[model samples]
Target: MQDLRTVLSSDTIIIGDGAIGTMLQSRGLVAGTMPEAWNSERPEDMLAVHRAYLEAGANYLTTNTFGANRIRMREGGLGSDVAGTVERAVALARQVAEGQAWVAGSVGPTGRLMQPLGDLSLAEAEDVYAEQIEALIAAGVDLIVVETHHDVEEAGAAVRMARQLGNLPVFASFAFNPRGRTMMGLKAADAAVAMEALGVSAVGANCGDGPEAVAKALEQMHGATDLPLLARSNAGIPQLGKDAVTLWDIEAAAMAQHAQRFVSLGARIVGGCCGTGPSHVAAIRAALL
Candidate 1:
């Protein structure tokens, strides 16, 4: 119930909620369909996911608006009402949180790359994130989490926009590959320092290969900056299961052990990514306790 900044400054190890896309998939959501659309069409499912995490003892519940930017919404047939859609997603999380947890507005990368590598310009990138972040703030989210970004500049764009929009805190999290680098080949230490320079509330790695790779990245990041760090790794590399169901390599107990390791490595906040659920969060809560 304390402000996120105050909680972070204290000795409490904050536990953030786990994956939304993967959890929705398990609840009969078809792959490749816009999950954010469920914000209206299937509010019960969204509420269930939020409730599960809150009951599992998550200090933060990240809203289900990761790909809610204008470009992705229009491309995915969800139209261009970015503000309305984002407000709806935040409402879903708030209904479940009920003042017991902080709702973090989730902003992910646009599927395109910036100039020299791709056509999207920096100004355009800022504009794209500006729209989504503005909606999140208007909807009264506690903070903005620009997560799962591979491009540092793109993440910085989100952070810059969020800072300009309001006083709400912003956390920038990047996704890393097994070699401890982003898809764009940025090392963890460099990404941490870059995001720190942008004045993010926290810099972290998420949805990477798994806990081992994430822990390694956090280790490098801890050495580079004095800012608070977060770690939200995937359960593990996903695998195909019977009936075409997706599965991950690491189990809940394994994830719990890594949760402890993340804190030991200087992550002030910890949680799961793809292939995690309430059980994983519950296990993390137990371990952290």
Candidate 2:
């Protein structure tokens, strides 16, 4: 498999596969459905989602195992199939990517907070991350991304686990609200520098806020470290109405323009997160050209 750095270096890599929960909901998955469980029950649909992104000009697709950690799986009644679910997620992505796109194993933060601030200790955090990383590596993921992190300490622990397990390139990304800060109040530059010191292959912002905010965060992250950058912002700020969250296409396009600026600011990987589907990725592809 081509390493993520090699694939990204060829051109600005356009990552796809986001809004897993929403997409599944659109397909009749209930409010509390375990999207990851679809790996065992509805593998074809998962593969179809991956193919859509690939066809939309995405150079990379993350597996649908973001919340597949043991802790979350138990809540979803999938605790027994954690490794199998992760392997299936990777296999399905590879099936769709074929020779076109690279598959990145998606590792979201464990729901618990780390020590000195919460009950979980550093050692416990390491063990949880190790389980996820081992499954991704065994499934032959081209790369691993630890994303949607809110706590700096937890993010650092996850990256450290990745390094100890293997040399596969690891990218660390955090979610930031529009206020220019993460849920834990860590600045973008602080997250970037900390992840860089831990030897992450890339670091940047993702999921929360619009592209403009993410672009500004990228600017803050610049010069914090020499590592490559990754940016995956939402299509727009979502609004809740009539029991649904809605985003506008025009807003997403405007965000794409900011994504172009992110590329200019030196982000090697760019894509959309929540509220961003194939259309958002297509816009990014158009912008790249």
Candidate 3:
């Protein structure tokens, strides 16, 4: 098989796997439990999730390390074990993906607001990101996926840290509101411009209002930056569920429709986020193909 860098930079559109956290929850991961912990504790289930996505035709497999940073891991009672945990997570995904799929080391927000907005300094934030980025690169991830970041500073920190540590391809994505704005009030074009400035391979939105909202955001991003764009939308807007929670009721076909819309707009990467599954990814694969 060709290398991930070549494939990602090629004209071919790539399909990323969907909703690892939710998939773990459905497979008996209790709510509020840190999903990254399962990388060491319940790897069988994690591998199962990877297999599900691969069988459903996904070409990129994100590791179960979304929240494996030092600060977050320390809070989860796994502080001193960060490296071990990350390495294990990547190994499991690679074991399942083999050479057929590329492993994306999933890096998430550090859970602390940056300076001027709150407290954490930019230098400290970069340190926090570097620890996880190093572990992911050492563990052999094909790329770094900095995702679910609502703050441009936070995401930029991660992307830059990855660049500082290695030459791997990195993708940075933000969560947008329905109006195509981030929680920090950054518009789609604004966020894309920021990410492009950080030198990431692709930039776009994820886990927002759903496909339509994400499509709208990416359309704006397409006009703002020349880099490849990624569209990883959620299933739909959330509806009330048990325990005062919310759930997505969007079906496979519905999400697939927007995947097509994203591709039509020249998005290079497309997939689902919250409340998505193998079936949704399969539909996306079918739609794009």
Arrange candidates by TM-score, highest first: which order?
A: 1, 3, 2
TM-score of each: 0.98, 0.92, 0.96
Q: lDDT score, residue 116, model 3?
A: 91
TM-score of 1: 0.98
Positional deviation of 155 in candidate 1, in angstroms? 0.6
User: What is the lDDT ranking, best to worst?
Assistant: 1, 3, 2
Query: Candidate 2, residues 114-214: lDDT per residue as tens digits?
Result: 77778888888888888988998999888788998999888888899888988888999999876658988989889998998898888988887767768
Q: CA shift at 262, candidate 2, in angstroms?
A: 1.9
Candidate 1: C-alpha RMSD after superposition? 0.8
The digit string of per-residue lDDT tens for model 1 on 1-289 reads: 7888887778788899999999999898899898998999999999999999999999999998999999899889999999999999999999998999999999999999988799999999999999999999999899999999998888889899999998988898988887779989989999999988887889999997888889889989999998889999999999898989898988899999999999999998899999999999999999997
**Index of the highest-lDDT prediction:** 1
The window of 10 residues in a row where model 1 has the poorest summed lDDT is 3-12
Judged by TM-score relative to the true structure, which candidate is superior, 2 or 3?
3
Tens-digit per-residue lDDT, 1-289, candidate 3:
4776677678898999999998998888887889988888899999999999999999989999998988888887776677888999999999999898989999999888888988988999898889899999999999999998888888888999999999999999988877888878878898888888889999888997788778888889989998888999988887878985557888999888889889888798998898899999999999898
Say which prediction, candidate 1 or candidate 2, comes out ahead on TM-score: 1
Q: State residue 110's C-alpha deviation in candidate 2, in Å.
A: 1.2
Off by over 4 Å in 2: 7-15, 243-252
Using lDDT as the yardstick, the better of models 1 and 2 is 1
Which residue pairs come into collision in candidate 3? none
